[model samples]
Target: MDHDETGCQAAPEGPILCINNCGFFGSAATMNMCSKCHKDMMLKQDQAKLAASIVNGSSSSNEHESVAAAVEVQVTSVEPKSVSVEPSFSFGFGSGESSEAKPKEGPNRCTSCNKRVGLTGFNCRCGNLFCAVHRYSDKHGCPFDYRTAARDAIAKANPVVKAEKLDKI
Candidate 1:
């Protein structure tokens, strides 16, 4: 989730820093953070858990406190995480006229038919526009390069043909 330059006050950028020492896993994860922070926190937690498991095996006394302290230290060190910033919406089209509004695009036009067609997905390579009927569903629609898709489809289909050949051999 992106935010403006002002920064996201709506939520914490990092996992709600492990407040409870009595956490079931040593640190209670309150809520989700941005992807990057969440990944790091999970790694640290895994390490802490491994350490706790090992320590518990060797010592009969209360090793939980030591593990909790370690988790707290790890959590504190990950402070001041960054938030993703969303781009601002704008309506300026490249038109030089400040007063005239940009013309709205009508229905999607297919390159092959030159007519309005349903959007399956757009072609990435040559940009030869396509509708659902013209699309290859197995390849995630006609968005990818048609030539590439055709070649890939042939290659994929060859496996079945080859199995038949092997049986005859």
Candidate 2:
């Protein structure tokens, strides 16, 4: 907005307010503003900064998307795809080959090596899918601690002993 639109004439004496005109007791709280007029100017500056940040952030996200696309390309190159062309017997009607090709489904990959694994691969209780080699929690560097298993086993084996110990304690 222009200086005229602000309705705030330049202060003749003070940096804050028009001491000659309206005694608008100014707010010095933020942006050195005596009134809403100055806050409007600051708001525009803040919005500009926010817009610049968003533009810069979008560039970084484009870089990340490129890396993901590269990975997808690599996976496609590594896999062998067999295209099955169905024979169309229909001259005008239908032996019926589907116009669109169906996407091929591939086996699940091991989280550790990114190698394809069959149905025999293990899905760990810790929630990770791995191959037979890293099937065990210990091998996969799983964070699940099984210390409670021993305690549960002992509690089950000597229930009376545990009851006596608890009562004594």
TM-score of each: 0.19, 0.29
lDDT of 1 by residue, 1-169 (tens): 5577568555544434333333322223433344445566777786666565754666334765544433322222333675443222122335553533469977776655555774654653545665554544343344455687789989898865433435544
Candidate 1: regions farther than 4 A off:
1-102, 136-169
**Worst 10-residue lDDT window, candidate 1:** 84-93
Clashing pairs in 2: 90-95
Candidate of highest lDDT: 2
Model 2, position 103: C-alpha lDDT score: 95
Q: What RMSD, rounded to one decimal, does every model reach?
A: 22.6, 25.7
**Global local distance difference test of model 2:** 0.59
Report residue 24 deviation for candidate 1 (angstroms): 64
Clashes of each: 3, 1
| lDDT of candidates 1 onward, in order | 0.51, 0.59
